[model samples]
Target chain A: MSNTTALPISALHERVEAIFRKAGLNAIQSGALARVITAGERDACKSHGIYRIEGTLRTVKAGKVKPDAVPELVLQEGSAIVRVNAKCGFANPAFELGVPALADRARACGLAALVINDCTHFSALWPEVEALTEQGLAGLVMCPSYSTVAPTGGNKPLLGTNPIAFGWPRMGKSPYVFDFATSVAARGEIELHRRAGKPLPEGWAIDADGNPTTDPEAALAGAMLPFGGHKGSAIGTMVELLAGIMIGDLTSPEVLEYLGTTTLAPPHGELILAFSPQAFSAGRPGDPFARAETLFEQIAGQGARLPSQRRYAARARSEAEGIVLTAAEIEQLDRLLALGLDAVS
Target chain B: MSNTTALPISALHERVEAIFRKAGLNAIQSGALARVITAGERDACKSHGIYRIEGTLRTVKAGKVKPDAVPELVLQEGSAIVRVNAKCGFANPAFELGVPALADRARACGLAALVINDCTHFSALWPEVEALTEQGLAGLVMCPSYSTVAPTGGNKPLLGTNPIAFGWPRMGKSPYVFDFATSVAARGEIELHRRAGKPLPEGWAIDADGNPTTDPEAALAGAMLPFGGHKGSAIGTMVELLAGIMIGDLTSPEVLEYLGTTTLAPPHGELILAFSPQAFSAGRPGDPFARAETLFEQIAGQGARLPSQRRYAARARSEAEGIVLTAAEIEQLDRLLALGLDAVS
Candidate 1:
């Protein structure tokens, strides 16, 4: 036996939505969360897909996150900056409500930013920025989550992995999406290595004493190192300034108290910035799209491909057939299914 | 002999200004170019300091750059997005006129962007971003210069080193700045390595055949690699879109035809984004400054230094004790000084 099973993409979304609803999320919350998870799976981000649902549900059960809390619009300046008060709930719902408006503002004003506060970020940041790119806008998003990283020179861990995601709308293809945590390897990747009994590549993490280590467990016990050394660390700090301090929200270090040891519902902040190319253009002959197409040709002529190009390829390939979950993964999902509806219990 | 000479900071600026004026630039153009070059030296950016003067002067002399052209404000949306047509001239002059207004607009509107098209960005990006931070605003500036580096997996050079610079306004202190070309090392660094006959670290560049090489000469003959592989490549692409494509200008490769074999005045675009934290803040009890102070403490506590911390340190040291320039650099500047004034000639 292959020891794997394939499920339809629609079934996956419905299952995720049902699970969120069963855990008592409101319709908007469940749908928003489900869409992101399904999209993540379709994009081949197994780290954030079906694998993350249990921990997300645990946040609802622990009473740390109010699953049905509707986000609030706290403040705005002109049409360029909008601040969303997430009311200590899932971030997807806030993005769902705020991003389209932010894109509209960007369309009108040339640029706009949506600063989200008091939100529990449940997964990767790609979906957040992709929303804007889908509407022919360029988008950049950053969020500072729980601290698990050390700054460049020190042994003490005082920063989060701090993922940043960006998307650029193309002429007719999928938007060029790029998303990554500032760390050399994500915490989940390291955890996977440990679970698989494999060692990590050098420079990924450190031991409890903060010396470099390839041992995933020891590195996890210590801290993740920022990618590209000081440059990545600086970007991480910038992320904190934008998503945390500028948004009047908790920075990675400041949010430590709110983080549960096992189940997490840390009320982090996310900052989304959108830009309209047409607004920046002077109505010139060689507009943005024409220039982008030239760049794409040049990039493709060389062996190097665009970021998230692989994701699009995987997505198309998987959608044609389906993705197969390993036996262990199936077991994890089955366990959640066995729990049934909390309302029934 | 030490082969180095120490000159007063004022002398450096005056010398640079004299060279520009001697080459037929107007007063504003001369002063703006001089200020940026002097600042590059004071800030210890040796690559762009006196070394870049001749190439800049050549642009003015060759008629590639309009030495006296005034950049026109072509378009603006609301108060947030300002697009400047650089009139086929030097960018510093345009930034000199546009940045303060852009900062004021950002202060009023919460976020603002200045998009410049048809200009030669001839100096370090730090000065441009620091302009906003000096006004107590956060700033990010990106520009696409001549193409030299390739995408991550490709050997063909399709993108510029593509510098990205950022600055954060600090309370009662020099603004924290971070600037780096999104490459394993800047092309300038590679040239320096070649001049010094030094070997490169791994993953820096690929030789003509697209195989990785540590030899500085081979690496220079080939294409430079992106910093942190694909993540940095994506950032490079994003910069091209924002600074080149979105601004309705030529992408890096598209501008390459105008570049001379030795001298460069490739007209490119620059994108400047500014954010006013005060505008985003709700005036809560714990203001943004307090959070920044707390963040500084955590950063210091963890023994991690902020980006551009070294530059500020360098500037302070250089200001106290005059910076020493190499004999070669002095010779280059002295050659221009020997030419005297164009009107006199």
Candidate 2:
């Protein structure tokens, strides 16, 4: 009656998975994709939620990502590196297959890295780091996106929005997490501004001639700026070196070249590093977890909020009251399920 | 005939080391301290060069740092963490003692971490990461300073001007490196402004009452803002967690509490992560080093200057023409050597 549907978390996941399956994604791909999408919605991260499904399916239909490919795990024995070849599929399943082994290696070696290659990557990196936090390990995750951001002092786009995410486990509480794009603003932000007939924010972008511009159209035709000026640009470059070239995968410019457009998920790689507190803090005074809580309490005591609190709060709400979707959103979901790959351009 | 004198790199190192030794520093402390200070001068990084010698002696005179303490390395068998307890000494010597083990572990484990605990730290972090680059590895180094920065949305100094430095080895060129304070600017910059009787730029800090202020005096008594707002604040907090709390050492606030003054070096911990590119790129296609050069070339082609080029250029100049010190600098160095621990209050 209210033109909305309240679905339990599982119900929403089932609906999303069913849609991916109908679109010809294998069980592993569909399930992993559905989980991430559902988690996005649960956390109220609308940008990465079910809205990504169409683009994902479009990538599959365009022969950009392999729908039925399975991710392969290469456990480099006696080493701290765990490799996962995504087999041309989405990065979600690849991350899934690698997390357990990564956790094991981290515990045994005290620090470990998981490298996922040949993956069509989507979803916010928080989910990936949160997975490690759930396993009681501190983690860092990073990956390259297609080139859309210009290195500071440069005119053209050469660096990706290259996201970096970090998480620390907290006992009996939600983990401490932060994930962000190195760019001043995400490309989708400019897209929204363009659609809204709005001028972009100052310092967010530069025009075609490498001069600052506020017009979203000019910005789109030009380049986005990295956050924090050169510092952020340097970080974006480091991501290219570490998560891209160091992992033997496509850099952001190469990803853009491969895809030819930004509409579809880009093929690249991911790097995840896990650190064990028990191993790191061994023989040293103070429990790392307890000390971290004190730091968090002091931060809050000073009236500063920790990162990812809003997401965690929304997750709690979603768990209690279910995910409420509007009529239009429900219709879109239904249409996608009904028409499968034919629903997209 | 002139108000300036030029000293070869070796002469400067020997002079700085003699002053430290006269000030009661042991061989390891004097040698390591001299190396970094000379490197700073050689690179034209005036802020960290011979200018920092008085502060070093002041800290030593105040008994905040152990002048003769030895560092002990603890190699956890079968683990990727190589730790060095600085025994209340300077972090430089501790870092030097741990690097070889860290490098070995990184080569063997694909990734490794070096943790330096109980050290009085006062040098720029570029030297730490550069040491790893010298060993043909990619490295990241981070450390917490005394609390001087406010977390975003907080009005008080609840975080440190934590610095993170990263480096990647390059073939036949200077290694790629970037090191920076997470705060909008270093505390020293604000102090310099105070000395010059100048107002700070807007958004750099908040007054004691939690309102924005450009008065350097108010900013110092209040809190410096993190760079890039919440993102940089989060990174600063991460430094506290990983480098301070995770290493079982003092956090920024605790360091402030322990030191009772920001003028002296803070006793805390440092975390250095090393990655062996050969191990990481073993089964992957393309050479990581060569690929990084391509990325660098494109960035430069677009007119973006890579970080640390200026320093590398200065090093080249110093190597050719020696380091030039102004008259005041020469006088201060001679006085510090003459007076030793009595040079400062």
Pairs in steric clash, model 2: none
Name the fnat for model 1: 0.79
Q: Scored by Cα lDDT, where does model 1 land?
A: 0.82
DockQ score for candidate 1: 0.71
TM-scores of the candidates are: 0.94, 0.99
lDDT of each: 0.82, 0.94
A1-345 in candidate 2: lDDT tens per residue? 599888899999999999999999999999999999999999999999999999998999999999999999998668999999999999999999999999999999888999999999999999999999999999999999998999999999889999999999999999999999999999999999999999998999998999999999999999999999899999899999999999899999999998899888999999999999888898889999999999999999989999999999999999999998999999999999999999998
Per-residue alpha-carbon lDDT of candidate 1 for residues A271-327, written as tens digits (9 for 90 to 100)? 899988888875765768777877887898886777787788878977987766788
Q: What C-alpha lDDT, on a 0 to 100 scale, does residue A312 get in candidate 1?
A: 89
lDDT of 1 by residue, B206-318 (tens): 89888999998999778898888888888898988888888888777877766743246678889999998888776533688768878877887877777777778889988
lDDT tens string, model 2, B170-234?
Answer: 98889999999999999999999999999999989999988999999999999999999899999
The prediction achieving the highest DockQ against the true structure is: 2
